[model samples]
Target: MDVEALNALMRSEFSQVANDFIVQSVAPMEAVVRMPVAEEHLRPGGTISGPTMFALADVSMYLVVLAMIGPVTLAVTTNCSIDFMRKPTAGVDLIASARIHKLGRSLAVGDVLIHSEGMDAPVARASLTYAIPPRST
Candidate 1:
């Protein structure tokens, strides 16, 4: 697949509507996504919320799927499991490194490791599955 075309598609379809997430960089099989930590993204522990991390994982995997399959607007997440390993710093940016593990006609799977900027270990790990739409051509 054309990586540039896929990136463009992601920007067009998701970037405009994803207020908290940003596509920092994109490659053929990998992508780096960032989410700014905000007060609204915090839970009772005064750290980033689980839902916020889940959103990051979701978007990161979505970008990875798009990178491999081009821009399929109908590509949807069928399953997602995330493990939160640590608390995220409130003011730091959360970065997710997403890589596609399998890409097929009907489905795509990827894993994302999310970390706070400057952190050595990941704060969360997520495995995601997305249903890819059929290609027209």
Candidate 2:
């Protein structure tokens, strides 16, 4: 799948929050995604919320999978586990780098690292498993 095509799919299919996440680059089994942190993404401590970071990781891996397997809307997150690391820097963007380790006929597994822009250490890491849709007759 193509990067531009993947982005367009995001725009058309997920217009609700599509603009929030950008598909920076996508390759065979990897993708870089970015989210321009807004006030809505911040929490009581004025830092990025855990849910926001998790969303970044989720979408990052989802886009990577889509880049590899096409826009399979039926593909769903069957399982996900995320670890919140250091607190993210305030007032900048968040980036997620995801790499897919396995892509089988029924499942896909990948990991994502989230970084607060300008920070050296990762803010969060996530492991995601998705269930690919079976082909219909």
Candidate 3:
């Protein structure tokens, strides 16, 4: 699936948080997703929260996998290791660029770098592994 298709799927299957994420672009084994930061996504310190960034990284990888494998909703994240490099800009969008390094029949492993809207370096980086449900023959 491409950007539109991925966004549509998110709206249909995960309506509650659909508005938070937008599929920006998608290619063979990679995708970029943007999250428009809001008050709810910020912690008391006025910086984007870790959990929120984690969610962004997770969904970005999910979209990347779906873009390559089609709308296989059962594909699920099995492991994730994320590093918070710095505090994000007060109020700006967060962009997650994910690339799938390994794609196998049942597992996909990738890394995501999340940047603060206009920042040169990433605010966080995550390495994730997802378990793709076995396809029906």
Candidate 4:
């Protein structure tokens, strides 16, 4: 799926979380997702929360795989390892760049680097695996 198709699916099928993200771009084995830092996503320290970052990382990879395999809503994350590095820039949108290293019939694996908007170094990095449901065939 491309950006528009994925965004439309998000709005139609997953409206609950659709407004929080933007399917910015997709290319071969790669995708970029954007999440604007909102008041609700912040902690008491004015920093983006861990769960919020994890969500971005997870969803970013999910979109990347979807870009390759079409809209597979049943695909689920089976494993994720994330490390929070630097503090994210407050009030800045976060950008997650995901790259698919391996894609298989039943699984897809990738790594994601999340950076605060305009920053060079990533604030967090994640490696994830998704369990793609069997095709009807």
How well does candidate 4 score on lDDT at residue 46?
Answer: 81
Candidate 2 deviant stretches above 4 angstroms: none
In model 3, which range of ten residues has the least summed lDDT? 37-46
Residue-wise lDDT of candidate 4 within 20-122, one digit each (tens)?
8899999999999999889989998889999999999999999999999998999999999999999998899999999999999999999999999999999
Clashing pairs in 3: none
lDDT of 1 by residue, 1-137 (tens): 34455446655666764557777777777988888887788878679888889988998898778767666778999999999998888879999999988888898888999999999999999999999888888
- Our model 4 lands, by Cα RMSD against the true structure, at 0.6
- The order by descending lDDT is 3, 4, 2, 1
Q: Please give the distance, in angstroms, between residue 72's alpha carbon in candidate 4 and its true position after superposition.
A: 1.1
Give the top-scoring candidate (TM-score). Answer: 3
> What would the per-residue lDDT of candidate 2 be over residues 1-137, giving only the tens digit for each residue?
67788779888999999989998888779999999999999999889999899888888888898889888987889999999988898789998999999999999999999998888899899999999999777
Q: What are the clash counts of all predictions, listed in order?
A: 0, 0, 0, 0
Backbone clashes (count) for model 2: 0
RMSD of each: 2.4, 0.9, 0.6, 0.6
**lDDT, each prediction:** 0.83, 0.90, 0.96, 0.95
Worst 10 contiguous positions by lDDT, candidate 1: 1-10
Off by over 4 Å in 1: 1-17
Q: Rank the candidates by TM-score, best first.
A: 3, 4, 2, 1
Q: What lDDT score goes with residue 28 in model 4? A: 95
